[model samples]
Target chain A: MSSGKIVELRQVLAERFPREIPPPASLLTTGIECLDRSLEGGMRRGTITQLVAPYPSCGSASLLHDLIDSMHTSASQFVALIDGKNSFEPLGNTDLLLWIRCENANQAVRATDLIIRDGNIILSILDLKQNEVQELRKVPLTAWYRLQRVAADSGTTLLLITSHYISGSCFAAVQINNPLRINDLAELSYTVSQTRLLDFIYRKNYAELGYAQA
Target chain B: MPKPSLFAVIYTPYYRLQCAQQKRLRTESNQQADLPFADRQTELSDQYSQSYSSNSNSITHQTIPPVTVYIREDIASALLEDSQIIEINPTAEAAGVKIGITPSLAVARAPELQLYAPEVELERQQQQALLQLCYRYSPFIESTGPGVCTLDLRGRRNKNQEIWARDLLSRWRSLGFAANVGIGPNAELAAQAAKFANPYLEVVENSQLLRSLPLESLQPSAYLLEILHNWGIRTLGALIQLPREDIGQRLGLEGLSLWDRAAGRSAKVLHHLQPPEIFKETIDLEQRLETLEPLLFILRRSLEHLVLRVESVYRLVAEIKLQLHLDSGDKLERSLPIPAPTQDITILFRVLSQYLETVQTAAPVVGFTLEVFASDPAKHQFDLFYSRLKDPNRFFQTLARLAALVGNNRAGIPERLASYKPDNIRLRLPAFDWKSNSSISAESDQPRIGPALRRYRPPIPATVELADGKPICIHSNLIKGHIDKQRGPWRTSGNWWDPDGWEIQEWDIQVTDRGIYRLTFSAGNWAISGVYD
Candidate 1:
């Protein structure tokens, strides 16, 4: 195809699909240089982001701890951690954290719904990393979509931490593959800050690229 | 010079009788009086007579129109004191029953007579209700006497005081009280206006209007009235016309005081009052409250009224005490603590409705008393960047809904229990002033490492092959494989003094297929207790 015809086709596609360009100031900083730069500042507000770590010791929990600590220290915002299967253990300042420990994935999802509807906390993390696959499977697809809607309405950043990709409604998804062995707490935290995750290509990127071509 | 302060006095005539009628309406409609409903007037009269005769000792039959009603009916009636007729109704007056006459003699003169003793408690409650109602109009109010309230309208500028007075009187009349309102430059003048003014309101610039009022309106001692009658001073105008120095010399302080009052020069210092802080209202439901909607409606109305009153005093409602009087004669009282002291009607209503929706009354609601406790508005210094909940009341309401949906103990902040047992924690409701602070530093002294374990509530039962007290393999629904790496059993037990004591042997093992699992052997059963994240 000729370049002019390609450009015309791109223009038509761009007109059909639009992508949200959040204000630079509205994005919440993760306090990690590479992560923030890759996501163009940090997580988008009023959207859900998923961190998928299929293997053990993939640094997802460390990332959660870092994000919570950063939010507490920098933004002075409250963080709610809905721990599915009652797994999450606090590693840093818990004064700003409201930990809701649930018995199963169902309970955690319900807790997330309540917290998002309350619209109180700035960040809500639903940690389902240790939930059994059978228990997690019990959650309906509509529950995740409902959570996304509530997150948008409440203007809260919902970060879903799980062992595998569970929903297609996430605004952004990143897979943790970096592996590191550490003997001390300091080394573990440093490794966590240094580890890089692969971000899955979102549909928004394709729309943006189409718009740029047009 | 400061302008003379204006005052308005609300005087409810026959306050005790009105209170007795109110009590009868409140307590007797559903219980006693078999009068036909179609005859509403006679039904009300019968209810009043029945209640009045039951509470009073002077009357034995439920046929007489209580003393005040007899007076209104133009029938002979007298109020007895110490076996003498202290006051005679107008009908009795026309029938030759005079004050200070023996009751038997007064009865002889007026062959058909009715008498009623005073109800002190009922009168006191009615007075309080009057004070509470008038306090809404003006903050500086005083319960001058039984059924009398003096309101200071100093800074209030209604174009016509008569219209304001009439509106007040109408409100009192709606409550089944015959009230008269009068406005003047001073309290004494306002009271005098209420007594003798033709239209119930008399705003006098001088003592000119006081001329026609009888000396009896002043309510002087009988000796003073007798003395005034003998002196041919029957009117306030005539009394004021007398020389003040001569009256003081002749009649002493009593005569001088009366002279000053009639002349509108009385310097009586009014006890400026602070309206009582109590904000409560009770109403008998016309129909049974079988559902939550009607009860909520009434509660919202009462809450709005109380919120307005609390706002008038620059305060906020901190708590609500709801008392439901059920048809079963049982009282259900619930005290709802406000998450945040607020004047918002919607928030207060939500708090009340949330409670009422869950409350299971023993019987149909017949009456209710709602009392809201007031507090000074809470002052919060919010953080510069961190925001608390945008609306705390809304958050609390959502919390309540969530608690209702899930069990109450299931949803809230998790607090770890101080025990050696694994997975020990409890949920707690958030405080009102929950806010985030960036200055809070982490407890870095004890930094934990390794992935947190996810506990399986009621661990899955498993079959394990043992070799020298070590698990060689495990078979379970979630994990079915040979154990690759294994740890020895760790034993823990607690509560030996109680029959519900527990002893458990736990082991950390990695299955070939399942990544890692915590196996527990308790009561001769091996189960997969949890999984390592």
Candidate 2:
């Protein structure tokens, strides 16, 4: 076939069987330029974003601190932290933070559901980095989907802090691999804010693209 | 220009009879006299004797006793007192009983009569109730007489005054009183209209309606009434027809004053009053409330009535005091605080039902008194862009439900306790004025650092193997694995003077398969304190 005819045919095919273009994700700025730039523009609103840090004492804790600090300083919004394993040690003024200290993954999940349904807090961080894998495994996949639905409905930004990937329904998963280097607390905070985390977006057309001819 | 003044008079025809009947019903069930009937009789009889002896007029003069007996139902009856019949019910009147006649003579005339002694206290209470009910319509109210109240409706705009009058009378009827409401320009005219009006009447032109009423409806002295009767001036119109000068020349100032009133020209100043602020209603249930549904039904009805009263005054209900009288002679009392003062009946009913659901009564409820404390309506202006609670009342109600589901002390905003003890916290209800801006502090002094801890309610017991004074392995119901890495055994102790003093060593350990865990070595026992999720 001629190139012009092929182009027209392609255009007709595209219109008849349209590609599913997801709506543009609304972003809620983390107030850190580096993080926002790395994730296109901060975190996606109304979706779960997982921050996985496999090793102990990785800069994930510091990253969480910076996210909370940025939200507090920039938007003056309240952040709810549903601590799964009771390991997070809050430092400094936590006036804008609601700390729901849960004993295990189940309690943390329940707390997260309650806060998400309440729809009062702007950002909810479900930190399960210190919870045992066995305990986290008990949290049904349905629970994660429910959380995702609730977060979307409420337009709340849910940041899941875990040691491994748990939520299949997450919009994107970012891994914090940089270890704790700076000893000074102030320098460590600044360094954590600049560190580039790996971002993995879960696409809907992956299976379709795999079946298509290259 | 002065506002056109309108007055409404609510008159209960058989106030004493209704009060006595109510008292009898109330006592019949309890088998106890809240106020002794015999003592009331003696008091009434003594007052009658004094008034009778003091008035040394002709025998034709009629003296009204403070207490009057009337036949309410058809039953065997006898004269409880030799005193004259001051008041008689329709049944007694039909049986040939007349005022000023002795009770014995009336009983002889008709053998079947059911006489009920007057409950003076109950009548006074009912009169006060009438005043309170009328006060809801107009602020200027006066207790004109027993079960009679005059309300000034001046400056009050109503498209249909007759409908308002009928509604007032209907409310009174629901309270067990056959009341009539009348509207006029003055208190005297309104009262006269009320006495003659069939259930409800309004006097647009006072002279027109006032002319047909009997002179006795004005409640003039017996001597004046007798003089008017002698002159054949039976109706107010006939009395008003006579020349004012002639009446003054013939019967002096009293006659002129009476003529003025008959002419609807009496400038009677009403005793304007401030209604009582107490919004309480006590209801004696006919049947004991054995279930929550019935109790809630009664409570909702009472709350609706009270809310109507509150709304008339442009106020909202802030709190409710519920006192349930149990059949066992014990009382259960609860005061429910409204998180947001509201005038919505549905919201108030929800609040009341939520409270009643949690109530565990020792005995069935025999009676209840519900008093709603009203407050001035609140005014607020929210920011244009700021987020607010979708429904504050619903949120509070949901909080209550959640509390009931979990526990009283479990749900709410968590507040940290001021102590050295680890995991010291308490839950407190959110403030009524919960502004989003108030949640975050304006001052950014403390540098935010580290992740927040997720505390286990009670630390799980765990076995720990130490290598060189450091935890190397950990096993518990939640986590079982070797410690991959470990942090310090931070020692802390406090409250040494008290018996609850504590000393502990806390360690942050990262298990191999499990996540990071906080281990505490206290009193020779090791336990997993929390997870850093």
Candidate 3:
């Protein structure tokens, strides 16, 4: 976030031409491209999911690209990429959403400011090495319940990409999505738009008719 | 004539688009003759990607072909900013003006005859030679960038580390590069330690230790230093006392980590290398060199010594340095980034002698030294059975050719050094891996902070194009670029409580070849976003 004013993609576009503001769709993905296809075409939003990897090679960034692309193409959504380690170097075509690169858990907390200021989807590129998650893990129940408790919290789907690194007790609540290889990101994007068996079956039965909401 | 470099060379481009085809951004690189694939050690390494799988190959096949007909304006050297960059691209870097002087002083150096001006070719020959040099030190070499490198010594410990250090020091000194060695548990601290030495070396455990060194040594944001000053924490040691929670809560993560770095709490590591390895050496000259004859003669022997030292070892040296002090004590160091990495003293003398005669003299030469550094080692981490493959010196030959093309930086290995500042944090890719490999970590298991824009020169550039006889951002002196349509001027205000606060108004406009350029005014300065194709 080079500028002091961090604006969302839609805001930047709509400020020039105001239009109806639609709710964002949260597309979660298993960091693995193959695994993401097995899911409902993409990772479902509004739910917490955990990713596990012993090594850095796991498709963490690739999955992030998927999740971000999902939030972007499915609907014009803004995203927050909290890079706790100061690692995520913005690629060329990533401005479709509002991406925030923060350094630690502290800046992550300020995430509230970004959401309130520019409404959009949010994800964490956290450096799990920070001890905060370990502390957060002790009482994930209280923390998450409180997070859920915040009555007026906006509808941004917060996707955290911490593997063995993410330590909050809340992690025990969700199913894990593990991706391998840094290159896997491209692999996951290709499958996001493709029709999957789950999509066909769900659409025939329980799947939402339109897009999933944040 | 200088004996030709006995090294292999290879060059390649990053992602390139083809005008002829509609899809697929393919890699544009060239390969060289086979070099040895041996290493002193191997990690939890995998060669799963050396040879492309049919899947990727087929993927590339679906891509477009390069078309000279539609080169990008930047690639075609049509843009004004790019025109300035064109001159910086030396055919070959004069052994990379080994010593970095003030920008003004660098400009002052005479445009002497080029010993080797290898044009910047599509292929990378310098990388091959650099890898050879790094291989001599360790299997795990991480490139800091062209002309600079780091070797992680923690994992690859040897019997005589100091002796090894001194030998390499003399080697680099002989080549003309100011070699500085920083030893520490993490890569950042070691890197910071290496900065003090202009041909200097030191070791520090943490930022607290390093902060005591000098403020300029640690490249953090200016705001960070200001915050430290207000807090009465002047030195790195003084700053370390402020609680972690206090820093994290106040300074933001990069700021907090910078404070931590000052306290010497770093854990970042080197990344796995691409192909070649990097090598280095600084002068361990006898307190002084006597006459010009003995001085040049001894420098040649040291150069030859370095050449033979790595003969059986697994690496090559494509660069050479001549850091000498005149009787007047005004030092002049000269280097050339040629493709040929050699040990032949006579050849070294002939190549260097031609350029030496051309340098303006202030006094008699007192100290003369030379050093050789690299691109990447020819040996990459493979699942091969051999533990260490020795270099056949072919990589040095390739470096000679490549160094002759792109300036010196292009001739060595590249490594990205992490920085709090966007520009400072840009990758400082060097040529030594073994020195850098020790710092690499297994998992990047970091917490998701958020999406950060890695804009080296922020307020990403946008050419406000012609529209209705106007360009975007055309009017305001602060807001540069062409003026297009002036959208709404939306403003956001927050963080009023903090000294470092913001009140910004933004406008979206369609810039030149660039897409929607985001023009912003925060803190009374205009910045444009949306750099384009």
Among all candidates shown, the one with the greatest TM-score: 1
> Residue-wise lDDT of candidate 3 within B1-533, one digit each (tens)?
64311111111111111111101001111111101211200100121122112223221211111111111212211001221211221211342322223323333442431111122221122333344555556656676644445665544435344545554553433222224555555666666655554334445455345757554456667887776777676666666767888888888897677776776676555664745332333333333444344444444444554554344253345567667766776788777654334434455555665455446666755444456663333345542432221222222332333333322433232233432222222222223221223221221223232222222134533334435533344443224555434554777766578885567766655433223334666665556642110
TM-score (chain B) of candidate 1: 0.67
Candidate lDDT values, in order: 0.71, 0.69, 0.40
Superposed on all Cα atoms, the candidates' RMSDs to the truth, in angstroms, are 11.8, 13.4, 32.7
Which is the better candidate, 1 or 2, if ranked by TM-score? 1
| Isolated chain B TM-score per model | 0.67, 0.74, 0.34
Tens-digit lDDT track of model 1 for B1-533: 98668888888665654554444444332322322332534544465455435544321222322111111334566666678776555577899988889988888888997665554655664566577678767888888988899998877867578765764664454344667788888899998888655447776756567777888888888999999999999999888878999999999999899888888877767786766778887776767878877677656655655664565354678999999999999999999999878766666877888788789987999888888998876678876776677778887776776666555776566556766566566777778887543265445444445443456776899999998889998888878888877765789888878896788999888766455667899999999887654
- Specify the poorest-scoring 10-residue window by lDDT in model 3 chain B: B19-28
User: Would you give me the overall lDDT of model 3?
Assistant: 0.40
The segments of candidate 3 whose C-alpha lies over 4 angstroms from its true place after superposition are A1-214, B1-131, B155-160, B198-209, B277-533
What TM-score does the predicted chain A of each candidate obtain versus native chain A?
0.80, 0.79, 0.50
lDDT: the better of candidates 1 and 2: 1
Name the lDDT of candidate 1: 0.71
* Order by lDDT, highest first: 1, 2, 3
